[model samples]
Target chain A: MADMRTPLSRARGLGSAKKGTEHFWMQRVTALANIPLMMFLVGALVVHAGSDYTTMTGFLGNPFIGVVMLLLIFSACYHMRLGLQVVIEDYIHGEATKLLALIANQFFTLTIAVACALAVAKLVIG
Target chain B: MSEQSKPARPLSPHIQIYRWTLTMMLSILHRATGVALYAGTALLAWWLLAAASGPDAYALVQEVSSAWYGRLVLFGYTWGLFHHMMGGIRHFIWDTGRGFDLKHVEIIARITAFLPPVMTLGVWLAAYIYPGAL
Candidate 1:
């Protein structure tokens, strides 16, 4: 039999179909970023729990809280997109369904990002 | 490459023939927990947008969330978050190409599956035991 090492070594340079490590690393990076943000977010929500709209609005309107909320939302949506993309790839069988699902996932996540950004901008800048 | 001349290769053991293991169960549960978390994010978005819209909208959200079904949803969301977080740590360990030994892998999988539910219950119990303390 021909040596297996030559073909195996040559294949290493071609890289993974999806450029593998990027997704893995991004998932970890976002997961780490979320640790603190998740704590702050839950704490913030608890603090605002019984507050009325005016009170809550004023709280969110604060520049610091607004920016933090914006960051949390964007990072979360990005993290979610990455995670769901993997799930879809694993479960969705047909090529067409997978492609469509991927497109929808990106569209939905991007819409959330834009809407969240706009809401925060209005709160902080208005 | 002749059709009749091709060799019959020896086959390796596969998952179908092997008994299910703790590690296998945890691997599937991790994906399930991830899907649950994805749904929870939609709820978060709704809460945020409702808060942004004003009093009436915010009140709508509060009313729903304070209801029995809403509380159940929130409970599930909390469970999903903690479960997925632990699973992610397990994945991180796996990513480093360590911890795949027979004994340690099963132990870690079992721990990941059990720890999150305990933590979730602990948090809720505390919230009830001392509402003010939380």
Candidate 2:
């Protein structure tokens, strides 16, 4: 196996497109980060369930919860955008359609991420 | 590399031609659940924004989400979230260059399939039954 590689091919490791497993690594990194963040989020929701707006805002106002939530939104959205791009790439055969879908995916994920972050910031800052 | 000149052959046997396997089903489910969560998180956003907007808005969101149909959607979303989360963990383990063994792969897929519903039920039960205790 050690002898089986062309020197150029062996060193790059990213293949021709040069993405170099970037998506794979990012997916794992975000997934690992999301585990605890999501747990915290679910906990917060459960604790605040059926409570009034004041209680929900108060829960999110706590600095630690607020920060965990921010991280969760950012990482989860990024991971999702990556996953969806792959999905679009795989199923959409038309090149132009695939590109448009990819762009729309990013736009949608980014919009959600921004909206969620703004909501968190408002709660934390107020 | 001409289109019409190429020999007649199936492009590739996608899901249509191949016998389904646990890994394949789980793989597809992972993506399906991911897409579901994409929408599910939109609900989360609505909740947050509703909270930020004011009491009236927040109450409306609360009323909507707590409605029977809303709860049903929420339940489905919960299952999707947990299922996708477990699937991520499985993929993470694979990224570590382990868990690809045939025996363990099936085991992991089975656990991934069953554990999410159990966790979702547990959370919902606790949330609904012991509202304040949580």
What digit string (tens of lDDT, one per residue) describes model 2 on residues B61-94?
9888888999899889888889999998888788
DockQ, computed on Cα atoms, for candidate 2: 0.51
Evaluated on chain A only, model 1 obtains a TM-score of 0.85
Fnat score for model 2: 0.59
lDDT of each: 0.78, 0.85
lDDT of 1 by residue, A21-93 (tens): 7787878898877767876875665555556777777888899998888888888888989989998998797
Cα lDDT tens digits, model 1, B4-110, are: 67468866876788899877877777788777777677677777677777778888988998888987887787777777788888888888899989888888988
**Clashing pairs for predicted structure model 1, backbone only:** none
List A-chain TM-scores for all predictions: 0.85, 0.86
- Which residue pairs show backbone clashes in model 2? none
